[model samples]
Target: MAIKVKCFASMREYLDLSEREIGIDGIKTVADVWRSVAGGKPMPENTLCAVNQSQANEEFTVNSGDEVAFFPPVTGG
Candidate 1:
């Protein structure tokens, strides 16, 4: 099984990927998903995430076939 990951805006640049599929083995929470693909880099404190389009925290459990998206907080003038 696999989880689809999407990085948006600045997060996409930071992660060097807009989208990728990751194996779900041993991945239980959204944090695990990040750890598996973050290449040892720490997640920014202001980063936000969504699971299946609904807002989720790092501790949110992720199942196989889930879509997880990460993005930096949005700002406007």
Candidate 2:
């Protein structure tokens, strides 16, 4: 099975990606997804994460065909 991953805002620039499809084997949690996609690069501090558009945490479980998204923290005046 496979999962879709999305990077948004600064996360896109940092990871040099907007979206990708990854194999889900052995990938359990959101943190595992990060480790797989980040490719040894540590996840950015306080990076926001979600699954299927709903807010989630690093500990969140992930399943095949899930859409996982990562975002850099947003700031406004």
Candidate 3:
């Protein structure tokens, strides 16, 4: 299955691509998707994730049409 990924902020630079499509087998959690995309480098400790704009955890199972988003942690004054 193919998952649409959107990388933001520093994460985008590190990965060297803002958006891309990846193929994974079976149903995998959001974290699993990250690991696959990151190669050997793990997902950032403070990364925030959303599945179709809703907050998603590592254990959240992903479907073929899901929009998996990854962004750096947000901070405000």
lDDT to native, each model: 0.95, 0.93, 0.82
Candidate number of the best TM-score? 1
As for TM-score, the candidate ahead, 1 or 2, is 1
Lowest lDDT sum, 10 consecutive residues, model 2, at: 37-46
Sort by TM-score, top down from the best = 1, 2, 3
Local accuracy of candidate 1 as per-residue lDDT tens digits, 13-63: 998989999999989999999998899989999999999999999999999
Q: Of 1 and 3, which scores higher on TM-score?
A: 1
Off by over 4 Å in 1: none
Off by over 4 Å in 3: 75-77
lDDT of 2: 0.93
Best by lDDT: 1
Clashes of 1: 0
Better of 1 and 2 by lDDT: 1
Provide the TM-score for each candidate, comma-separated: 0.94, 0.91, 0.84
Candidate 2 matches the true fold with a TM-score of 0.91
